[model samples]
Target: MVTQDELNEKGKAAVMDFDGDVVAEIAEECISAGLDPIDLIQNGFTAGINEVGTQFEQGSLFLPHIIAASEAMSAGVEVLTPVLENLSAQAEDKGTVAIGTIEGDIHTIGKDIVATMLKVAGFNVIDLGRDVPIADFVEVVKEKKPAIVGSSALMTTTMVLQLQVEEQLKEAGVRDTVKTMVGGAPVTQDWANRIGADIYAENASDAVVKCKAAFE
Candidate 1:
């Protein structure tokens, strides 16, 4: 059985090495040793990613390193996700957030970051991935009853889909059921308000703050 200190060390090195497989193995070991998935993620994996983000921003790390760290964190998440989901505390949720990059928008870096941040902050995120159509958003909202729905668009052309999603949600009579939030390279708070989205997050971290506010 791996000790807690060893697992923590492995988790930290996994991020530094950008080794997703190593991260996953460490997480699995921790679980096999009876460690809590939520605890590992919140205290270990999240801290690693936040550090990577800072380093990347400060030019101490390059894009390749960032991608590797993201991949490693994602791998750890894959192993921990089921365990987290089965835990009673996780089931209760800080809040349910449905997220996606609008239709015609294949850009996902921003959405991925926001989703990760939300997860780190204890929000249950249902990510729709990229290029999601209007129907998916409406169907998910109806099925999951999420407290917040978020959309991202990197291009002006794809930004229109954010409005389309809002319109569909309204038409489905579930607009009021969720607080809509939108963001990306070309989005603005005014645009969010104009399109009937309840909030606009300026960045990934800001998304967490805004969603927290919406839930509060």
Candidate 2:
């Protein structure tokens, strides 16, 4: 029998190499070995992405590398999603959240990671994709009406779009009804408070913790 640590290392390597097929392959192996899906996500895929994140911040990894790793992590998570849904039936859905990068910001790797972590943590995630307009967020809040809305912006220029989103959400009259979460490299807790955001996530793992706290 393969040890959990060994499986985790495989998962990590797959993401580091940006090999989506290998990531899925490791996920299948974990399933065959009866390992928990969440554990695999954390120890295997998330662990790898976390390293990729560090390397990215330190300049050892480039944007394309980060994107590839995120893609690999996403593929592994897709493989685990069904099994997680089954687990969710045994547990309870935390809440619904809509996530996206703000308008004019094409960066998405971090946002994608947060979405995956949220999903594994039992949240129903509605990903709005990258470079999403503020109006779309307001419209989604008016239409989909998720419990929370999250925005990501990688640049100081684009980060203000998160503030704009909050303003629009308030204008739409759903501000009081929904919680707004903000995150990205340029985002900070003070910034979140200044922007009237309900939550500020530092990373993918922290995002899951904060999302759970919002409901709890």
Candidate 3:
């Protein structure tokens, strides 16, 4: 019999190794063992990605490694999506969030990680996908009436579009109804302030924390 501790270790190792298959296997074992999938995700998979983030910050890991690890983490999450959905159905809705990469930015690894983290945190996430037009964002805000709208821009040039999103939201008369969050490699707290964004997430973990706090 595989103990929960051993399964946790395997989950961590699978992510660190960037082995999506192993991570999926661990998720299956978690279900079979009647272990809480949320615990494995929090303690095992998320812990592994957190370590990878730390290493990236410490200069021991590069962008490629971060991308790979994010992909691996996403795979594990994909396998557990059905179970997560069932669990979500049984719980009270936290809030709704509409997220996307701003126009002209094709990069998605960072944004994808943040979206996954938000889903794991119990928010109903509406992923707008990469290279989303500014108008589309405003439309979603108006239609979905989500609590938060998150925009990601990875380049200095593309980051300006996040400001446009905020402006459009205001123009559409929905700015006051939804909190706006901006994040990316080139985004800064000062930038967020300059654009009148409600939140600036430094990373995936920080995004989850700040988004949750926005309600409190």
Candidate 4:
């Protein structure tokens, strides 16, 4: 019998090793063993990716490694998506969040991870997807009235679009209503402050922490 701790370690190793097949296998094994999928995601795979993020920050890992690990994590998440959805349906609603990658930047891996983490954390996440225009964010804020809006930009050029999101949100008369969060490789706390964003998340776990703190 595989104890939860061992399975958790296997899940983490699968992601750290960038083995999508192993991650998927772990996901299936968890389901078969009736282990909590969310537990595996949060404590196992999410923990793995969080370490990867730390390594990247410390210059021990690079973009390619991050991308591969993210993909591997995504594979495990895909297998758990159905179960997650079922569990989420029965769970109490947390605050809503609208998240996306800003215009001119089509990067989705980081954005996807954050969105998934938020959902797993019990937030009703409206994923606006990659290459989202500034106006779309404003429209969603106006229409959905989510508690938080998150924008991602992988390039220095596109990071300026996060500023535009702040400006446009104010223009739409919802700047005060919703908190704004900015992230991506090129985004820094300084840039987030310059753009008047309420939160600057360095990675997915940080995003979940700051976003949850917004409502507290």
lDDT winner: 4
lDDT of 4: 0.88
Model 4 C-alpha lDDT per residue in residues 70-125, reported as the tens digit of each score: 89988998998888777767766789999999999877877887887787778999
Query: Cα lDDT of model 1 overall?
Result: 0.80
TM-scores, one per candidate: 0.61, 0.83, 0.73, 0.77
Where is model 3 more than 4 Å wrong at Cα?
1-9, 47-67, 106-123, 153-160, 184-191, 201-216
How does each model score on lDDT? 0.80, 0.87, 0.86, 0.88
Superposition error at 111 for model 4 (Å): 2.3
How many Å off is the CA of 112 in candidate 1? 0.5
> lDDT order of candidates, best first?
4, 2, 3, 1
- For model 2, how big is the CA root-mean-square deviation? 2.6
Better of 1 and 2 by lDDT: 2
Clashing pairs in 4: none
Q: Please give the distance, in angstroms, between residue 198's alpha carbon in candidate 1 and its true position after superposition.
A: 0.2
User: Candidate 4: RMSD over Cα atoms?
Assistant: 3.3
Error of 2 at 198 (Å): 0.6
Across 1-216, the per-residue lDDT of candidate 3 in tens digits comes to 888778888898899999998899889988888887766776788778778877887899987887787778778878877887777666556799999999998777678767866876788899999999999999999999999999999778999999899889999999999999999877999999999999999888799899989977
Against the hidden true structure, what lDDT does model 3 obtain?
A: 0.86
